[model samples]
Target: SMETNKRNYFGISQGLIKFHPKQQYCLTAECIEAAAAVLSKINQSVDPCDNFYRFACDGWIYNNPIPEDMSNYGVYPWLRHNVDLKLKALLEKPISKRQDSEAVQKAKILYASCMNENKIEKADVKPLLSILRHSPFRWPVLESNIGPEGLWSERRFSLVQTLATLRGQYSNSVFIRLYVAADDKVSNRYILKLDQASLSLSSREDYLENTTEAKSYRDTFLQFMVDTAVLLGANASRAESDMKSVLKLEVKIAEIMIPYENRTSEVMYNKMNISELSAMIPQFDWLGYIKKVIDTKLYPELKDIGPSENVIVRVPQYFKDLFRILENERKKSPHFCLNSFRGVFPCGQQESLVSGTFISSKQFYCLLQIHSPLSLV
Candidate 1:
């Protein structure tokens, strides 16, 4: 089974899977089933005690799963996370006054290419225009505004390994407490340690399967999910939209996490802010840690911090500082993005998300500052 599973790497994993891959109708149940089985296997192998994201999926892909509207393989969770930050920043301001940020422009261009029918269309669009028309839902905006693209052209991609399989292929993945002194002295003595059981939950990378029909159904499902939530009496506060937002946020962050397939520890170590995360261990640099955890073949693109370079996402200050370092480390790596479903913003941030904000939620989206926890241990 190990030999067979290892041999099935169809080179399909090399790049993102666009829906219209030359063949207009190349989706097959066999392929989706294969993907599902892989996911099921990975889930099964996941230790119930561990953090699902760590073992269930790789760092980059785990952080950036595919979106639901269409089977977009390119737009990832991290980039989307960046997109979300730009959007949230805009939304925080008066709608009429919201202006385009660099990340917003990048998202629009990237999103347009993934979902647009015509290659030449400008992806830049107003938030209201986007919500009313181009939302993951299939409804036309207002009366006669037809969206520029059809949902049929989306793409999907994922990776799954059963518990039985993962146990055999690799050592269990876990998180451990760390202390990095100014001298760069690494001590495994005190505090937490990396363990496989920490990442036990199985993750679903692509929102849904890659079939054309499945894609359409999913678009409609997500559309209704948002629309229904909108019509049901509620206020449009970020708090109410929490449920869908967090779900979307998790997958978005996973896209970035997945690429460092085996670098869970290194990714966690490099992400300086991750250590500061509410429940996370002290003094961990997740982004750098992830870089170190994965083999060179699956190394992540660590960006560099520079005055001229725009930050991809509005990460916590710790992360903002480390982004440049991560970028520098990943300078030579290829860039891949994932597209996720976008719906009418739900009324308020959902409760589920608020509660779990400390989880994967923080990885992509920003925290509401539930409490003013002072920095450091």
Candidate 2:
């Protein structure tokens, strides 16, 4: 058994990383892997009554099909783009080769039918049923009715509600508290300990009022664009004058948007890659976090989660300094600092404020300047 304190420690750490889209993928993947290992162990072990394997397997299925499209929606260009690539490769594989081959095949058929993407749509229910029947354990007993729904009940929580519960529980337990919301079910409360108490509807209405400020910022940014357009349009003799105006606008807008709190919290947002996030937060550990939270000690077989990389954050110099300050605060007090920016970067609200930063951009290009001393232009 893992140390008891490890559970609380990881639960909080994972909660903090959950705020960023990339980190959440990493953490969830870790859970699936741990659960898989536990399941394998139970199937091989002489003892089948072990409750640990049962819980681990059920938890895996509960959050299975991490809904890749919905998982990293509206995220920064680098992380969002990478996750899609990884998921595409994962789904492209034939079912016989998948980690949970039975379910993977079923998922492919279901998704193909619903979306009709022209990909493989054949479903094999035999392997799926075989796994279900052999498990000897049943879900719904563990609060997840995620097996073959026909064999279970159609009354299972909507995917949105189920995801919300998972997100909430994850936030409450981990270091990174992400802002996850499914359009189907928007919760009245933020799940992390920082905002355990429910916020009033009126208070949320008041917060949405930031749209006015957002619009003001948008107008200022638009002017900067107009000035750039003029700079490019101007004759060579007038180019310098227009260019200077554009530069001036750039400085002004940078000063206006991208607040201090958001800038300062870099480590929370960008430092750790998904793998590192899994290691940093103890709550998602193979032994302790799973054992305590799910009432099972056995770890699941690790799932093959993809897009193995850290989230890329383009931090301006100002935000870099802020990130250092916030990092220190996080080291000192984990729970207090994770959700400090809650009022500002709340759920479903765009946190991408500055223009230079492409934390939320889609069309990104990298300019590679390969300098060779032997080359002459």
Candidate 3:
């Protein structure tokens, strides 16, 4: 019986073996290169069981020292750097107007524009000043003679429209930040979410700290803002005053912001409909704001956005205080609210930026991970 069972198993194995493709040594260039890469990064002399990390990484550490600019080095960054080089090479390839796809041509055009320092310098800050001179974005710091559009009008001020337009057109979100993220409760579903956002300074600690270093950093930040406004045809005194207020407003936002430690997943998951959001915070138009920002022209399906549309309010308290501050601040300085809207004005700041820095910063853009509405990150 044992002999018969062994024979049966052998027969099955033999049948399956004949059906499988014959294995051969892969000596292709790609296979050899991949093998060489692994071989190069391993120290066979060191027993892996005794010292696994060193055995695996010693050769890699010896061969690839960290670059001067990077604070840390690893496989991920190395792969990213290689990918960027490949992308740069592809984008640098000459565009064939008739041959290339529209998307490829557009990418090539953008890459060419970024590389063109002379053309960018020639244009100067005119593009930026032109944007600021327009309705809703007319920076109050700039006087009437700044452009044909003249000074920002108090009559045209609508908090809902201004906030919405900033996000919609310029891709800048002021008080209310919108994102499309997977629901915590329903992992498979993606939902629109609103949160407090856009502070001038990166760190909330910068606003809260009373240390000398914090104070110095704040002063320098305020000075930078004032200098930027003055460079774009704003009066020095008025620029200083308005920017000081802007800085203060940012600090207030930082104060109200929920600390990272406090922002557990459960705390942030305040799911509700648009109507509930409006009822909760009656000062601002919740439905109008979301509708304005979402370009129904492009996303025609989104045109049916109504009070019943679902959304997650990440920080309800922040919105409550934010509207309260904006309401009080607007009464004092009617046109000043838009100043925060144009905080991240994309324009020529320094001569170096116009000359060589813009080209250098193209590398930064390639590395940047922006959390835009489109990205949903």
CA lDDT, every prediction? 0.33, 0.33, 0.73
Scanning candidate 1 in windows of ten residues, the lowest lDDT window is 368-377
Candidate 3 residue-wise lDDT, 1-377, digit = tens: 97677667756775675565774557899999998999799886775556879889988988999764333478987887787778777777899988898877877776677567688689887877777766767777887448657577888767777778877875677878886778889999988999878565546787789987567657767777787878777888988888889888888879999887988888998999999999999998889998898888888998999999999999999999988887888888866544443434653122112111232455435323121232531
lDDT of 2 by residue, 19-121 (tens): 7555535348888897666555343322223354553355344434333222222225345457556655555455674365665565554433434423212
Candidates ranked, most accurate by lDDT first: 3, 1, 2
Cα displacement (Å) at residue 76, model 3: 11
Tell me the deviation in Å of residue 80 in model 2.
Answer: 1.9
> Can you write out model 1's per-residue Cα lDDT over 25-128, one digit (the tens) per residue?
42599888877655653443444334556445543455456543223444353455576676545434432325766544544444434333343234333343
Q: Assess candidate 3 and give its TM-score to the true structure.
A: 0.72
Report RMSD for candidate 1.
24.4
Choose 1 or 2, whichever is better by TM-score.
Answer: 2
lDDT of 3 at 264: 88
Q: TM-score of each candidate?
A: 0.20, 0.21, 0.72
